[model samples]
Target: MTLVQRELVEFQDVLTPRAISQFLGTEAWALHSRRSFMETWVHDSGVGRSLEYVHIPTDRDAPDFSRRLQETASTLSRVYAISMGELAERVSAIRADLFFVRIARDSADGTIPLRQASGLIDSIEKMMKAAAIVTANPLAKGTGRTSERVRNFLDDDLRMGHTKRGSFIITIAARLHDDDIGHGADDPGAPEREGPAAANRVTRREGRADEPTIDFSRRVMTTLSRSLAVTRRHLDHSDDFVEFEEARESGMTAPIVEAIEEIATDSGGARVDMRFSWTSALPHEGLSEEPVIFTPTAIERAPRVIERFARSAGVPANTDVVGPVIGLSRDTRAAGEEEGDVIIQADVRGSVKKVGVTLSGNDYNWAIYAHRHRLPFTVSGILGKKSGRWWLLDDVEVDASFLIARQHDRIERLGGDAPEDPAAPVDV
Candidate 1:
């Protein structure tokens, strides 16, 4: 496809979300009248933050400097640049902490736990700063620039009022069919705008019960949580960029975001309705390029990876597949003391293989997690031709040892005793 032709083909096509929807087999990843709450403060980091890098002779750094620095050391809008999204993904892949969350919102029925949603605003802030440092330092070298201060909002700073005030309607759309980009047809969600009817817009299948339904707000929050966790893991465990290439397969090249809906805030915070659509198709690399790195700690503990499969009932070695993890089986200790297992929706190339693996009864710490309710993972190993299933055998890296970073330096995990909103749903 020619450059102009490709752009034209991609035009108005809400591709990625649709691709995501399609990948998810949903009608649309859409939410309606969902509320979003954010407290914005006039911190140097939060206020007037720019992806555009400029030279002060004294400084040059961007967590997500999206600019190519081709001519006159110019810059580009993060909304337009893929690098910022990539930077965000890289940080998220590590699943590090960017916020000290405070539980705030939930559904009246208590089904939607906004409190469970990972704090994203804080992640964005942290990543932006991190990107600044990474782009400049290259090797995790500390920037001696005193002009920068840790992104902090507490005590006396909170004493000063910083409340964002406003109300607006939003429509987030996605269309996937490989026309050009996950770039779905242009709708109001394209660029942040204002108005009333604008307050309410509609996609083809607006609120069709049969179309598809997903708790998008919760999904967003979950994504934020997972991203934070990955960052925390990477920062605490691995050394440098080695993690990126360690895995053989990657969806990192997939087009995740065509654009970003930059949140609006001047006062410490703002609340708005967040609507989502779970269409039929979306992209492979999530909506954000920030990847979720899966380092299998379970493999190290497994007694026999390939040999176990060899002994299984008519198992075939080296079957490649990519799909979501369905469920994790635990001991009858949890169920009825049944043997442990891991269920997977194994898409072997194009074939749909619903497979399950007997677990080692251990590996829980590094074994299971749900990405959007279904864990999307990839592995190449044995598949029983008869039973059509296999166990998670060993770590991907056969020889390399892994290390975990010191725990003291981590952003504290939200403890059970931590303060939660009194207004939040009751513990059921």
Candidate 2:
């Protein structure tokens, strides 16, 4: 068997002459000259400053096309005080929200353990999914089916860029829609315009729309930032998760905390820094321009927080939940005793979530029967979460009456009587 590795994307391959010209045009560069196969763009700083010129190849098929493109990129990098890779990314994702994650470790080299490297990528993806879910549905607990909008955004709009040197750096880009672009200031770093004129304009704009429009991309990042900030503060100051619970509206969920823990643990307790770079093309407001650093203490406390959040988001105690028996697991037990775990596809709140319940003796037998019959099972218990799963404790029993009624409903929905022969066992 042979393994083929994915080819890395290089700046020289992506940063073509046309991309350079478009980027330069946005930076106020003016066309200086044109030749048979090339064009010159000049950026003049007025007065005493020397004019900076970049040569762009008009013909990509020309022999010196690649060379001219590299030269143009180098000159632009120098002019912008950024690396060629950074310039290339800026040009490529002009309308995207950029996130940079750097994993710090004791190792001198930039390489990470193979296990941790895989974990890092998986964790980053989970973090983005959490953010996107919460942003679109503010009250989402992330225990249910994800919306199609979020799934589409993750599949189509989000992108992972090439990794860079210096401990391990991951770059993520989330492309913004055109309507999402016009909300923020053109200059991200510039101070908000002041005085009565700006104030009156803001007032007039506020009057135009009863509710301010939400930028999905910006909202996702903002929610993530707020939730992370809350987590860090909670770790720094208190042990109680009351404040953390309040942050649910800010996109703090079990998955987000778990993702942070994965990154922190993979880095071997070293700090992890996450930086945000909002596109200048659509400069967003209210996002923390400052980087969020996951300190050792915060990382250490993350597991506890994740547990608390999951438990908090779980179904309330002493409640009766009815759902189909989806799975059953039995292990060796003492003589004359029947003990096993049964998984119920219960509806929690408005979402269907799997609830794990342990039953013994008659209850266990009944669960097996329910599983065999493909019938909905009803159980009354306290629902809690552990190890990222929902568990039911105490009073775990099948409601015979509710089960019968649900089975009847299923048969009715089928528009006929169930066959006399037992239905084939459902694959859990």
Candidate 3:
């Protein structure tokens, strides 16, 4: 079956709160009265501020609390199971959206963890692992739902804005699938079809099949690498010089230029070219916000730069600049020099810097900074440098001393020698 089909089946097995309570050997009445396990405990704000009291009611007719707890646990478990199933589907989907049957069979045979699936994605896997580590210790059965604990668990490990309980359950499911597939028994086929003799044969086959096949995680990594390579090539050859002479410019060119320069500096002084245009108009009333115009020229080239940087840094590609009719900009500045643009600034954690883009009339500018390097950058330009005098700046210079010092410090920290840059021809 296809991954989607498998997902549909798994989704149907989602358990209800009553079922969860029964599984946990708890009364349904107590579970429902406390808002589904989240309101059972409170955090003290004073010194030694930890969870003070855990309210796991015993023999009480806390129908509301019982129902709540059952609901919460059931919701959490069901969500997690569905998420794991989806992640498995995603991995198979990466092979072919309809390859879930093979993928599931392979997974059951110990080929790969469900977390390695494309549906789970890297971000989801990371979140699942983190959640697994935090929630491994099962809370006391009657401790009610500890929302704060759950929230903290999600916050410390998961990406922001993805902390819903359902989301958390999905993450947990992926982790469970990973663990189960890693150490669980292989499917023994239909019992009636196999019988005792067939079972013996299956066991013998499993022992012989102990050797691992193509590592699913590695395959995923390889697939991502190849996809990124193709994306990089497209970005490199994209038509980045097109212009929109007829549209009303929202004045974002300057900010876009600044973003390019910033990207170059962050990229260790690489070379880059930037182009920006409005994709739509800003709303004058409650009708809708003006949609800044995005030219085709900018859209094609943006993803190449983004994918290149993401691959080099071992990060996920940003999706904002990957689509058409979006105000797009491309950057290929020299490594370290890319940091001079607002769009490519690095944080203390070495994450990409983000900045807000503002449009005014036929021009625009960006306000962004690199937290780690403490470097600030900006972009500004007009709609048409020739007719409307709109020209985009694709490159910028960085403080050479700062770059050298930073490079040296990084090398020293890593106990390694500074690497030399290879000489290459400039295309522009």
Candidate 4:
């Protein structure tokens, strides 16, 4: 069977909530707590700063942090398992004209940057390793050997050192999740929902199996995105340090830390909250008139078209393509639809020429997927003329440089990139 066929088969077993819990070796509720903790820590710890110094002053804080960390570790264990589940769900939704395509060739070649994909794989691997280390020698768990390993990977390997600082922020934040619950039980707030009458309602509601459920995946994704944002700020601080060191050599008066403080204060405190929103192209009966067709043929050919396009773009033929399958749509007034503008399009030739590529609603969907999966895609490429036409040209060049530049700018702005020194004075 072809790679597409293989993916189709694999998608049958995609991730589910119960499966995710099993893979992570933790319950959904516990994972939620862990995600909350990480997000909080990222917010509290100024970017680029070490998290080791953050103190959990109270016994309550200590237990919360420990519990959250433990839960996170457990959840990491189930990464692959959960991924399988996700894949399975996607496959199940595949239509006759569309199926999952594997770019194993591009992934293998260094053409596509595998950093993000590798990071994700490595995250799961490291988690497993950590689990092994913890289980094999339980004594090291408290020493944070596993946590340290995971943190170091986030810092050194992923070039996300700021995230390590944010981890502490998460630790602190986890305490807040239940603070209201604990406080309300003892002390009531104005117009409180914790009086005797409220208590009876709460007790009554607890018995309902269908209490509004939290979307754990969304929660986790949001927490991680926010953590990345804070980490990006910390990275900026590190860059500032580099600048400070260079300035100091030139007899500059201010210290780097001071500069950081000044900037932080001026900016109304250095805090980041990365927001992500998703929209589905799949037609909603009430809001949209577009039809979402799920054809197996489309699913089977997408990967081939993507791979061909990647190859035509001069990217390596070997690269692992992995991530959530996303569909996208937009809201525009009926009049706006009449406006014609130039849009870059993708052309794929050969047997896969008719293949269609489906993308999530917003550009960020692809960006996040590429970032998380480490797929180096041409940000600026010719837009497909029709909704899903494919072609190949001898010297097809797409000016995706703009997209790349934008991505780079965002990364640098968020402090994900090392700071560049101001161009030295040029000799006259």
Best lDDT goes to which candidate?
Answer: 2
TM-score of each: 0.19, 0.61, 0.19, 0.18
Q: Rate the local accuracy (lDDT) of all candidates.
A: 0.27, 0.66, 0.27, 0.27
Candidate 4, which segments miss by more than 4 Å at Cα? Answer: 1-7, 15-120, 123-211, 215-218, 236-428
lDDT of 4 at 4: 39
Each prediction's total of clashing residue pairs, residues at least 3 apart in sequence or on different chains, is: 67, 0, 91, 69
lDDT of 1 by residue, 57-149 (tens): 111233222121211111211323443223222212111112222212333442222321222333233323333333333343112231232
lDDT of 4 at 365: 40
Candidate 1 residue 362 Cα shift, in angstroms, is 35
Once fitted onto the true fold, the runs of candidate 3 whose alpha carbons sit more than 4 angstroms away are 1-154, 157-395, 406-428
